[model samples]
Target: MTTLAEEVLAGSRLALARLLTLIENEDPQGEAALDRLFPHSGRAHWIGVTGSPGAGKSSLVNRLAQAFRRPADGSPPRTVAIVAVDPSSPFTGGALLGDRVRMRDLSGDPGVFIRSMASRGALGGLARTTPAVVQALDSAGFDIILIETVGAGQSEVEIARLAHTVLVVEAPGMGDDIQAIKAGILEIADILVLNKADLPGAENALRTLRAMLELGRPPHEETAESLPVVWRPPLVPTIATQNEGIAELLGHIQAHAAYLRQSGGWQVRDRSRLQTQLEELLQTALLKRWRSSLPEGQYQQILTDLQARRISPYQALHSLLGEPPLPQSIQRGSTALFNA
Candidate 1:
């Protein structure tokens, strides 16, 4: 069999899906594949779509894909990858796998690569290995990548750290939902998409958003002689299921991309994302090593002792590794345990 990396580089869809599965499972080979592919990444534009579960994020992403499918010239269409994250069953630990069902029409399209990932207990709305999967898609030459989160409340904020642009989707008659969104998602959104805008309360929602925009001051102030400018984010209304406003959404995305480039925020965002990813990788590796090196049954004993209050967590941790607590003087000179 061709190695997963070779097949992925050669644009084999099966290999791409299989590789994504391995990475999601955190297989050893997946780590090796990421190591091989990292140098080849950094080309694609990553867009993240997230909101409450009923906001139609998948439908919006599907429409966005349709809008971007055709290249400007008569040349072949640019490849696009969609990573749709779904909630896994608590009992079975398997995804409900509904994203693929929603996106069935685009599954067979050679120009679009769609993969549904199970959250698999990742604390944030994203999958634990989502960044790795995105890297694989990026290195595989996908021109654009869309990541859809599990729609799990505020934790979806993490998507902003990974995506170049984040679309926060909302719908009609969701005032409380919109308030909840403001707590976290609002800060991350590059664009706010009010989907299902044909509904009765859509206008009210739009007005609410506009009022919210007016409350916040712009990041920068204009000189006295200059025009008083508002840095209001683009709020676009869309009926995604009907394919209305998708073209405009694409235009907004392109415009934002241009803005990022011109404002120098693109490189800064990219660097910050890469740095966060590096730290996450280090954390994963350290946890794996720590888990593997622990003596059998030691963790269970620690837990039992913790519950009984016979041992404090700090003392138990030090005891498990046969280390004494360092003196304050020594601690100042030495690196922290996390660094160690």
Candidate 2:
């Protein structure tokens, strides 16, 4: 029997879905399949779409996917994959919104695949398994993967590290222009999209965004040869509900992709993302291995002392690591008196 990874490589959508589920559940089988599939990954362009709540991000993403499937410049259409992340239900940890409902128009397309995921309390907008899911999609031969983040303002900059190009969507009349000035998320945007452009105050919103971009850029130097290639983020106004401005937006996205390739930003982003994933996996593995090696109930005993205030948190951590506790005067922020 062909392995699931082999099936996915042969364009089996059902196998792909099953593998995604296994990966999300942290199944060992999924890890093995992913390892088998990793050699085929990294070919797709990862695009991150993020912004404030109710900014029409879903609509924009929907239109962008269509554009990818039918390029306006008469270029061959590319396969598209979408990973839409929704907020998790606080009680059940289930996705609150089914993004597939909003993207029903693309459901019949053979070249497009959409996956909805729950944030599951993972911070910074994406689900915990999103990058792994993206890798699966990439290995399956998708040309572009759009990752739509949960609309969490400010704390949503994680996508900057994952995607080759990042689109920060903002809507007019939503006070997003003001929030753009205050939010660190704007710094990570490769393109600033003013979605809902047909709404009132659109021009004002556009002007505000342009001004902010100007302020963020470094001043021009007289020596032109000394400067490096810089991509100034363009502001594209779109009425996504009507599919207006989508072609132009796609043009900008394509341009950004070309720039990344020319400037080596593509490889840089890939390296950084893989490094982060490696470090996180290493940390988790080390913690689990260490915890399993400890004497039964010793970890719990440390926690008990920690909660009772009999030992400071630092002391508890040192004890768990089999390290000698530092002197109270030497420990940073050490105020508790240790009784042990």
Candidate 3:
């Protein structure tokens, strides 16, 4: 009998979809399959497309998918898997799946697979199960995996930790000149895309982005001891609606990939991403173990004491951990307060 992981490895699309659903739901079977598929992972190029709402990220992803599937340079087409993370519907807890609708053209292409995911109230513009899903897609033989984040703003820079290359898309007339400085999102960009370039104020937006890049550029003096070489984010203007600049953007993506390989940054990023996943898993497991070990109603009692101001939160934590008791002064106050 062929296992689901074996089926996915053999290019079974139905098995792949079922595996992804199980992974998103955090099923144990999915984890077992992922364990088996782990060795086959890490072969795909992870590109993240992220930006504020209304920046045309979905259209950009659609165009990028097409470009990869049918390369202009006459290179053999690459298999592309797109993970579009959408804001969850509050009422139904389901993804709106707007990207699936916009990317209708790529539906019939066997070389392309698109999955839409709900954000599920997770912060940083990505769902909690995203890394696992990407891993599954990677092991399933996709050459390029594009993770399109939920419409996000400044603080949603978590994509940087996951993607080998991150494209921070922008648009004209968004007052992005100021937002660029205030928002840390631009800092993570390997490529800065000014989409909707056909719109008015496009030039101004482009110029502002260029200036920002220049300002953030690291010194590259060779004669003297210079700072480590940094990959400055290239600002590319595009009208995603028209499919213009898609080729150039694709070139930039390829260039970044090549640079990472040459500079050994590829391994660095992969290690960092793995480390993050490990730490997150460790934290979750530890919390779960700690919760299960607690005496029945002990945590609730602490919360009651905390509410009544009988014990400070720090003391409560100590009590929970079986740490040293609070000072006599504090204990007296706690008792009196509790009695009162």
Candidate 4:
């Protein structure tokens, strides 16, 4: 283990922040530390919050975090981690990372750690390094880790695959009734939230979401034979700024967490997350080796052929794979492009 990793496990917030920065920058050493720290992970509950841009998700997260840290809940004080993703430049693919300003109130609490990350133009409403960042926090002994996505509309359901529990927030008056509760976003919601519930048209939004949920699944039926039980997501209304429904929202979150543990879903989700992490790392390593082995001029010619549709991609791959290895001076793998 690196000295930094030891410090992070020892509860040094500065060391944890430094490690996260390394992962954010895609430093190779960051990956090595994650590998060393993997055994210490699988301890934190991963929660993801996603919604449209104006859904009051920031306030909602802040309130929920405070509730998690509250000692009056009959449990000891627990540590929490927050990762807020914000959009960055399209040209440079950098992030503005202004989400921290909204969460500044949570600063300076030794039990809370909030990180603002740039989306870096990733289409999933999350930074590419988010999983690694979550792993870092998990290894550092955080109890609950909440991730707030960029809220870039329906295509941003990447949280479903990344988090153990996903809270999908919606605000009234954002769109037409039917258009507001699109199937794409609803399918991924483990808990649906109707934020801004004090605003006009809140009832209509609630009704629309309720009706949509009714139409979404077949209700449980008593059968002659025993059947499996399934979880149905409940929609909770909240006015975050006023702290309305915050306790109820958290109650649902805790119920979902308990359900996951009781149903063995936690282990299943952890396996899925680890599989994704392994595949991503393997893809990076393979791509790096492939680029390193390419004998210069040969790759550009392939790109030109691909652009002109003069040759199929499979044909190009086959040709490249059939080619001899890079010259000995290159010091890369000495085998052929795709074969020994």
Q: Rate the local accuracy (lDDT) of all candidates.
A: 0.82, 0.90, 0.92, 0.87
Compute the lDDT for candidate 1.
0.82
RMSD for all candidates, in order, please: 6.0, 3.3, 3.9, 7.7
Model 2, 45-163: lDDT tens digits are 99999999999999899999999888878899999999999999889877766788789889889999998898999999998888899999999999999999999988798898789
State model 3's lDDT.
Answer: 0.92
Q: What stretches of model 4 exceed 4 Å from their correct place?
A: 181-183, 221-228, 312-314, 323-340
238-274 in candidate 3: lDDT tens per residue? 9988999999999999999987887778999999999
| lDDT tens digits, residue span 1-340, model 4 | 4487888888888888889999999988787878788899998999999999999989999988888998447888778999999988888876777777777678888889999999887888898899999989999999999999997998788888899999999999988865865548878889999999999999999999998888776677533333324568899999998989999999889889987887778899999988987898799889999888989899899889999999768668877888653456553453455475
Considering every candidate listed, which one attains the maximal lDDT?
A: 3
What is the overall TM-score of model 4 with all chains considered together?
Answer: 0.89
Per-model TM against the reference:
0.85, 0.93, 0.93, 0.89
The worst-scoring run of ten residues by lDDT in candidate 3 lies at 220-229
Better of 1 and 2 by TM-score: 2
Residue pairs with clashing backbones, model 3: none
Tens digit per residue, CA lDDT, model 1, 1-340: 8677888898888887888888988899988887888888998999999988798999998888877786343565667899998988888887787877677668668899888888888866888888889989999999999999988865578898899888989888766535743556666778889999999988888888766655553776554544223334688999998988887888888777776766666798899999999999799789989989998998899999999999878878898788987677776666566486
In model 2, which residue pairs have backbone atoms overlapping below 3 Å?
Answer: none
